[model samples]
Target: MHVLIVGAGMSGVGTGVIAAAAGHTVTLVDRRPTVGGLWSPGGHYPLARLQETADTYRFPGHPFPSSVRDLPTAAELAEYVRSHAARGGLTEAHFRLSTDVRALRRVPPEEGGGWTATLVPVGGGGGGKEQLRADWVVVASGRESGPPTPMPPVKGLDSFRGRILSDRDTFGMGADELLAAAGVARPLDTTKAAAVPDAVGSTFNSGGASGDPPPPSPNSVVIVGYGKTAMDLAMTLSDGGATAHVVASRRHWRMPSTFFGFISSLPVLYSRAATVVMPSWAATTPAARALAGSLWPLSLAIRWLIVAIAYVSVLGRRDLTGPVPTAALDWFRQSFCMIPDGFRRRLAARRIVVHAPDGVATVAGPTSVRLTSGVVLPTTALLWCRGAEHRAGLSFLPAADVEALFAAGDGVRLYRHTVHPDVPRLAFVSAYNTFGFGTAVHLQATWLTEVWAGQLVLPPAAAQRAEVARVGAFKRDILSCNREPASVIMDRFYSFFDELCGDLSVEPVRVGGVAGWLRPLSPDWYAGVGAEARRASLGVTV
Candidate 1:
């Protein structure tokens, strides 16, 4: 089978390598010069919270140097993923680096049973967009592919002399472009394989990370949003001795880097067992009726147990809870902040002031921002780390084909977040899910490969959509508590993993058997996970 996989980052490469090893003809396309979409040294370097071992974040067999720190640096991660991609069964000939996927159109299976993809070379268009055919198309673009939403062009007097920074400016290509834009002589790519052009923080002073070249650091920074990127920027600025103030939209549940002081929260927050507590049939079937009504008492009991465990486990930071609704809880993370390294100390020391449950009301002056609280804070650099818009990633498809691809407005309404109901032979990797990023993408990639290869079969399109819609409703209800709906992450990774493994007649990761089930989901147990997934692909015994 001929397969076209988009994005050379972790998801794309992971999907491509395994599928290619399975004898599927695969082509991995990346617009960037190197791999590691988020971790790439040449792109926006948001710090992915990996409280677990580096093994949790990597593909099976492909891992960071064991000597790398528990909290590996971005350069370390980028290099690790790049080296792994370079070593995969899929060779350099299979990868089209520095290339962008312009659009995708699926050929009716009746016609030829494949999709026609359009590719455009990014920088120099000498390649002129050659069309290619593939039996399957996998969008491994991971999340955060789109450009960050531009900060509201405020009534700022443009005369205010300060660096106008956004996440793109702080952690993305715009960071490199800033130096070039200022005629600061953007650092040349000195190291070919080591230096990532888009992700290189060298000379950018984006942060004093790993002793890279030092770009000028901001003196005072007012950050927007509190996601991974915002926290990273805050840390970088504070490290540089800058006064960092975060204009947080809502207070959120924050856990120490460790869960309950010593427990690794990665397993709990995204692991298979911790993710899906409901019975398998309850998700999309009549069994769910008892979830709210007949089992209302049980539901309350379960919610109480989960919430109480969390409160006790994380030692219950009061800022995360109700009354007036301060910082909101992490919807998918189940209120586990998992942020370590003295974030609380920073808050207490007054170095970082979180003006939360209140957003930036307006840009008061050229160098100041008026909060919804009417407290005006001076700003040297205003960096918005708020997320990017959700893209369907099917913009390249023909309009009619695109219409069938979506049941939810602009989102991919695919079964298991992989194959669409109406659109056969198409799958997506790397949407935000409550699972280890590596494991989640690995499951989807291999499972879809198996499904396409006839090793497993999926449910009917209508049945799949029914379950998806129910889960979507569950996501809405979960976020309705905080009034933010669209982005709620349900703990569906392991549930779906179990289902896919069942279809393929393979064993899911056995959380119960590991360390007497004390740490079932820890990435350390992931050493054998890939072999199991591949075994499922081959219908081999464990």
Candidate 2:
């Protein structure tokens, strides 16, 4: 089988490696010039680092070099991705870098059933149209693959005169360089704004030059959003000697790096048993459902435990001011983040001001922004970290299938979050965005390759559609906060992996004995998955 995989990020590379191992011809394409999609230095915000430790967020059988830091930075991950691809025998011939997939559609039955992909170089004029055909297509491009979504038009935004920077504009920048580029005074030199080129991209609005001078005080940045990017940006700016004021309408629960001061939360959070109590998209098997039912008390305790940690890390801070709504934990929302270091201490120290349950009513003038609460804050630069708009690239599919790809409320109608019931010979990995996306994609790609290799079979079309509908209903009614068309499964990674493993005819629980329940669920536990999959393909018993 000739497999054409899109995106070239963790999902794309991982999918290609697995498919090739399954004896398929793999070709990977990405719009970015680099191999790592979002993890590439050019693709992410300044100073971005992995939320998962290096050990937990990696491909099967390949580990980050021991010298790499626990939370590898964007550059480090990019380098590691390059090495992983090479080690997996994915050479230059397998990649189409700086390439744009113009269109993808199924070939007519008379012409032999397969997929025809329209490809063009990223920049126009260098290459004419190129046609590539494959027996199967995998849309590994993540839903959130593009730049940060711009904020809605602010009243008086056009008239305001300060520099405006979106998350995208600051890519590959340092704290001081970004501040200087935004026309804000550097920490050491507050009197004069440093020179920077005009806005880097068409989307970035370098707001008109203001007659009013930049703020002399340090910490002149006002960041809009509470996502991980916003938190990390605030800390980075603070470390650069500027105060960062964070503004948001509401707070979201932030998972701590550890329990108390000494315990590591990674192992606990990575296990399937950790989220057994939390309501999830239902288990497909009867036995799994019964086991979940039997663990209701443990689930309740876990919820309380999460709440207690949130208070200790963020909500309980006495020095903080503002009427921020306590983040709802009933459903695991996508915005749930791993709290950064010193976030609580900075909140208590007033270095990072929080103005929550409020919004920017309008840009008051060149040097001030008026909040919905009627509080006017002096601002030298406005940095928007508002999350990106997720899009399922359906223009490539036929119009009829495009409509079929969506369920009620615009949720993607994907069977097992991989293949659509109406679409054949094509699958998507990491299309349903989730926490621990790397880990999720690794397992999903394995399952997908197994199906493509005929080692694992999907249920009948009717049964597949029914399962899709059941999961869609669960999301709309229970996990209402996750409304992305490609639903965000917030902490539901473990259960989702279980579903994929079950389909692959392998044990979902990697460890055994009593320790399996509490021990850290490391990716290493599944290192032998490829061997297991090959055995299954051979019709051999484990």
Candidate 3:
């Protein structure tokens, strides 16, 4: 069987390795000259840390170094991915670099039963839109492939006198670009001082000029949105001695990675458990009484415990303390936990100032922004870290099936997150986003390859749908579990992982030693407590 995979990043490469090992002829495609997708150094967030662990990112047998924690740098991850491919005997012939998949259409199956794919080459001239028939087409092109979200038109935006930039344009720029753009320099580096050559040079003709008056450092920067990107940018600017302000419409919950000087990898003891216990307060509907009852108090107690321990153990310890008050816990959650405490302390002291309860109402200029609160902020640049949208690259398919399978709110429509229901020959290697459950792509690829090879038979559609629906119900119940006194979100995170593992027939492993056994058991106990609390608080029952 021949498989065509799009996107050479983690998902594409991971899928290729798994497919090749299964003895299937696979062709992986990506627009970049190298693999690793966002993991590439060229990616804007190249130095970013992984929010998960080594085991979570690597192939089953490819264990990451034990010392690695939090998030691996983009460079580290890229090297890790390349090494995995080589060690697995996966070759470059299997990858089509600098190739973009423009469209996908199905042809009659080669053996007269499955499907063949017609792939159009995007950039190179060699494959003149060749149709390489395949048994399956894996769309691994991730969420970031789409065009950068357009900046909302704001009144007076065109009239701003200062320079403005977007997140995509911030890549690879040095201090000189920053200084010039901010209007701090008297003579900009005309030969090579351009920030975004395409956008800046085309408009200002500044790149080739030998001598040009430097621009003034703008007063401030207005960052739009509040996801990881926004936080990261704010941190970067602060670190670079830039005082930047972030604007967010809502208060975001941040999970710290570790407690005191310890690593936060052990889920049983770490702060992440709080997330699982309480569903995201941001969820709209109320959670099922049973699940909600079990999670809320457990999460509350854990959060309190984390705070208490931090204050007692390291709040004043000079070695433990730095720029920010040292908490006995991982300060920032996600994959960046591996970054040293001193750095976080510095970040804290500098204080990445945040503006909450207010979002951008309009962009008056690149340097000026209006808040929903009616106040106006003067700025130099705007960074959008607005969340991502999921796009299924199945546009070529007839509308009906695409609607049924790829439509939003569709339940586990892809088989084990791989094969499509109606199109069995077509598999989607990386589509879903599982928070913190590392190695999702690897696990997905393994299960997909098995199903493709007839080694694992998936449950019938009805059963699969039933499981998906149950998981959905469970997720809803957990998320809406509480309204006030915010419930822990990590507890529910683990529950979701449990459901995923159960659905995939993968055994959930305890991360820590003897203490780890206690983690799984705590869910049931917490469920009972959460149910009682919900009944008391919301008068709800399940």
Candidate 4:
């Protein structure tokens, strides 16, 4: 089987590796001159960490190095992936860098039942244009590479005397150029500026002898939106001694990585316990409703007490590994999973004010933002951290294929979140958005590959459609159960893993208490078991 993968970042590279390992000929194409996708410098968040567990985060068949811990930086990840590819004996011939896939069409299959794709390379010493046939095409292009959202036209924005800048331009320029562009004086010396922490130094900085502060315009920076990026920017500014004000459209539910020295222990425990104790049947019962009503206040009280204890213990602690305790897995079950109220209070007290129930109208100027509340904030700069949109380079796909594949209700229609119903041969790997480290992509890719190889057969079309409806309904129920948005990756990771292991009829293994004791070690064992079981179940010769 010949496969074409678009975008060489982690998603693309992972897809290529897995597909090629399955004995399929793979061709990886990307617009960049490199293979790391967003892992490359200038394409990713500078301080981002892998938000999920390490076992779920690692590449297939590669052992994680001993020296690494916590979340790795983008550069480290890039190196890790590059090493994996090299060790696999995958080389330049398997990857076409600086090639852009202009369009996708279904040419009749020359060999068998599957379809073929015509790939057009864009740039680089004029490879001109060549047509290549493939049994499958995987769109692994990442979320961040799409075109930037246009800035809303703000009234009187152009009239501002101060400089304006976009996030992209901020990333592009050197520190000196950035400062000059902002009409701010560059730091004159190392001592004072170095002493002052929390400042994000961009491209412009020159070593100097005399100590002098950069000229201060207005010391206030008004940031729009309050997602993860906004939170990071605000934290950075606060560390740097800048007065940062955040205006949010809605109040966000923040979950700390750890609480009272335990990482996700309490939330994990509560979720599992709820599932075990209150089965779906009982949840809908009238008696259950009465019981829930009577116990609701008590539940809230218990949660608060656990959080209060954890908060008091972590205050003024300096351990960056996190103060959360993980010795007992059930410790995760005791505490509230979201950011403790104590932390929110601390942030509020420190002038990191939240202007929720209101959103930005437009930028009045470099020094002001007009709000929807009819109030104008006097500000120095604006940082927008709104969210991202799913945009596949649609120009490359045929109109019929696009209509069939993309969802009518929400812009993308995925069948079982893998193969397109109309274009069955073209499967997308990393199209779905998850909170952290492309877990869904890896899981979906594995399943798609297995299905294509005839190792795992889907139920009949009628049964498959019914299963999709059931899964979709389950997702909706989970979404309602938790106030947070229904994350495809978070909601489906375990279930997908279970299905891949040929155990869809069984419930997911709950990891709490005794199971929690099994966690740190269990993931590895589970992977091994899953792999062997899948191979055996599919009758694949491995």
Highest TM-score: which candidate? 2
Kindly report which residue stretches of model 1 are placed more than 4 angstroms away from their true locations once superposed: 46-52, 61-63, 108-111, 150-162, 172-218, 259-336, 392-394, 399-411, 479-492, 509-516, 522-542
Give lDDT per model, in order: 0.58, 0.69, 0.51, 0.51
Error of 2 at 393 (Å): 5.6
Ranking by TM-score: 2, 1, 4, 3
Candidate 4 weakest lDDT stretch, 10 residues: 200-209
Q: Write the per-residue lDDT of candidate 2 for residues 400-494, one digit (tens) a residue.
A: 66667764654566887889877887788877756666667778887777676666777779888888888887677666655463466757776
Residue 224 alpha-carbon offset, candidate 2, angstroms: 2.0
RMSD of each: 8.4, 7.0, 11.8, 8.9
Kindly list the per-residue Cα lDDT of model 1 for residues 317-347, writing each as its tens digit: 4333222122223333232345555554444
Residue 133 local lDDT, model 2: 96
Per-residue C-alpha lDDT of model 3 across residues 1-542, encoded as one tens digit per residue:
88888778777877787678768998887767787776775555423556555544455556676666546776778777787778767788888776656555556556565444445555555666655666677777655554455666656666776555665565545544544454433332223212222111111111121222222234455677555566665555544545455666544334344545563524543333434334332221223233346555654565556546544443332212222332222332211112232334433342334555567777665566777766566766666665433333345444565665644353234534455545556666555544432345655665566556554566676766665444445434433322211111233344433433443444343344545434423222221221232233321111
Whole-model lDDT, model 1: 0.58
**Deviation from native of the Cα of residue 220 in model 4, angstroms:** 3.6
Sliding window of 10 residues with minimal summed lDDT for model 2: 197-206
Once fitted onto the true fold, the runs of candidate 3 whose alpha carbons sit more than 4 angstroms away are 65-70, 108-127, 150-156, 161-165, 171-219, 260-351, 363-366, 392-402, 409-416, 419-423, 435-438, 473-513, 518-542
Q: Give lDDT: candidate 1, residue 337.
A: 40
lDDT of candidate 4 at residue 172, scale 0 to 100: 34
